[model samples]
Target chain A: MNAPAAQSVSPAPQQGGRPSPPALRFDNVTLGYDRHPAVHHLHLDIAPGSLTAIVGPNGAGKSTLLKAAAGLIRPLDGVIQRGVPARRIAYLPQAAALDNSFPLTVYDLVAMGLWERCGLFGRIGQRHAPRIAEALRAVGLTGLERRPIGALSGGQLQRALFARLLLQDAALILLDEPFNALDAATVADLTALIHRWRDEGRTVLAALHDLELVRASFPQTLLLARELIACGPTDVVLTDANLARARRMSEAPDPHAAPCVRAA
Target chain B: MHAIYAWLIGPFVEFDFLRRALVGALALSLSGAPVGVFLMLRRMSLTGDAMAHAILPGAAIGYLLYGLSLPAMTFGGLAAGFVVALLAGAVARLTQLREDASMAAFYLLSLALGVTIVSLRGSNVDLLHVLFGSVLALDDATLILLGAVAVITLFSLAALWRPLVVECVDPGFLRSVSRAGAPTHLIFLVLLVLNLVAGFHALGTLLAVGVIVLPAVSARFWARQVTGMAGVAIIVAALSGWLGLALSYHHGLPAGPAIILVAGGIYVLSLLLGRVGGLVWRALPGRHLEA
Candidate 1:
């Protein structure tokens, strides 16, 4: 069992001609729930300022990888190293994980993005109002400030979540299927936000199923099937051969499978 | 006006016990309703009920040891509720059982244990007092305890407001950004236990959740925001306390059940005619907002 060596390890040079260090690194990491490995022992390095798409079939380790990166799950083995502080990392879970039935206005929900700054007891002072408004406007949710989040359409709710993400001002953003069930317009709008984050030198990792979107926007890609299949430039990573392998590998997993003895 | 005054104001003015009950009810509502609102929002209303029952054995033990001592019962109940909550939460986390299932199991066991403990030595009347409570018999010490609990609950809630909302709405996101999520949740459980203990002193363990949950469920119909819901729940609970106390005084009804019944009636009314999303309002709608 050979560890898949990550291609594209050469990071883009920073302002002073120094190669910027990897923004994230997985050192022989294995992620799982209850010792049933959802993600196999693998190694990968994500460069700072890169927009990477993690593509995989259903039951693939895309979400598990993202959760581990977001510090929501501890690696069952090995380690995940992050370039930024935990507070400077933002995570947007799949829409289903959020409780929209909560009695909160759009304004209040979006304002929560300031948690890293305002903290538990800090006030959302007058100076922060403009940022919230700007985030809402950026996502085209300006007038819906007072509307309860439950009333927002699915696309509109995604937009509101994006607005919240914008206010997060994070260095590393982990989005778990940000465009699932969204219309084309909302996808385009959110994709543009992703591009803007890349342009601003923020690292963005999104797990997505849409291969075309990944080919179009994501420069780097990691194709996974409970284990890394291919990782490199999107065109090189999303080849027909790799896609077939991923589909085959992602078939119903055995819950009783024994642990791997091979070292990374 | 004279009859209204006689019916409403006369009870409090004429009787010290009525006045004490009124003050105790107001304090409980002021603090307990907000906690209830959050509990309802988090979909933990039944957990609140479970915790109410979970406190019974501790209070019973306190009764057996000290015989109706406020400090003994309050401390005992708090300790019991806290342990049960922690155990249930731990079981849910470490095992496959859900929190609700674990909580239900623990509370049922605690209730039976509490009853058996009390029935070992105390009379049926003592058991009834422990279960049903006597709000009219609140003493100076009990009133002070209620006031103190209310103050602590409000201040703690204000401080925990942000993290609590974040935790309820999107806990994964909160966990990503800060360490406040788990601590906020623990503190919220502490407050819930604290309030239930305070409420048990006035309404007894069986009826304690009445004030905590009934008004919160009713407030949902009237408000569309969390703060508004909390505010409305407080108002509803306070009003029910007043009206129920008065009705109990006049009719010789059991005070605790009377108070809970008033809250239940308000819930029904709110369900039908509340301003926000009531059945009647939704059924007969005339206005549309521009998109």
Candidate 2:
């Protein structure tokens, strides 16, 4: 399939005529478990206020990259620098990662987003009440505040999680498969919120599988297969050739192996 | 009214041992029950059981060394409990064995070592008292120790409340937000060891977990929220203590086992009749649909 033309190719220039620093920069970073690199030698920059989609086939290090950005895991070989402090970033793992059996109310779970401000000892001040209410209303979950999170349907749980993201109000947001298993209505609502965040000058990087959705909404894309295949404006980065290259690159065996590498 | 007074009030008013037993049991229930509630919530009930067993070798060593010295036994139990927990946690992290399996292995070894040590130094009577406890024989020193543990546990639990809840619900989220996660977990383990050591003085290691776990599990059937569950568990624990002391006074039953048996009875009853999610509620027509 032909890739769509880029709609917002260039970021708006600053008043001083200097390009803004990237919100996140990965310098030759390699991340893995048990010494098997899932993402290797990745040099990339996520520009401030940009909404970027990361897409590739299964096991393409999409989630690993997001975890590194969130500072949940350390890189084995290189560095990741964030313009904002780690607390100023919000990360939402795949819904499956959460234990729904936990007996927490929707209100309590969403209130966790305020932990950066309230901390372990501080009370949720009255000033935060309006914001929490607004976030819940924004996600269409105002009426479900008192209900247990386990009682929520999958779509409702996704909405509740989005409500939490709204509360986080982070400068940089990393979402891993946020729209997986979501119905069309929930996806549309969440997509509009993402657009609003971009309009508000917040940076968002989402790992997505739906190329059609990526082409429609994301102005930039990073195509990966365990390493960077392409990174640029969406239309230029997501060409048929790039995807085929990623697939072939992912399927091929490692040629840099020492003879004893397998044993190690 | 007379029968009630005779069965409950008369024992405590008439006998000094009964009053002391009641006080010690209440102190244990206050702190131990809440810990149990969290243990059950984290699905670490078996770990709590294992930790209790692990305390035995240390207490036995103390018994062997100091000849029933309360301070020595308490210190030894705390040290041994902490060591086993740390070793099990380390082994689980570094090896292919799951945490539960490692904890089980360590605790079993501790139990065997403890029984051997006790048998080496004392008679069968001494072993029986150590295994089942002498709730009626609590001295002023033991009472003071139990009270101190309760106070410290309550304060520490209050300070660690928010972080502990976050850790139990989603440890990864806790780690992502702040550096308090590991310390919060460590503090919780310390509290567990302290409460278990305190419990050993009254109910013995074998039966102390009953006071901690039974009431908490029973409360699970009745309360939907964490605080609510803890509150219910505390009440259940206190009630078992009082009723168990009464039965021991009037009927000449063993005090520790009586308390545990009372708590077990409540657990069974709550499983059938509790308001939150009892078997009876599930059995009722249309109740499942409503729930």
Q: lDDT per residue, candidate 2, B168-207, as tens digits?
A: 7777777778999878777888888898888888988898
Q: Per-residue lDDT of A74-155 in model 1, one digit per residue for the tens? A: 9999889998888888888877467889988999999989988888788997889999999999998989999988889999
Model 1 alpha-carbon miss at residue A86, Å: 1.3
Q: State candidate 2's TM-score.
A: 0.94
Please list the Cα RMSD from the true structure of every candidate, rounded to 1 decimal place. Answer: 2.0, 3.7
Best by TM-score: 1
* Model 2 Cα shift for residue B177 (angstroms): 0.7
lDDT values for all models: 0.90, 0.87
On lDDT, the leading prediction is: 1
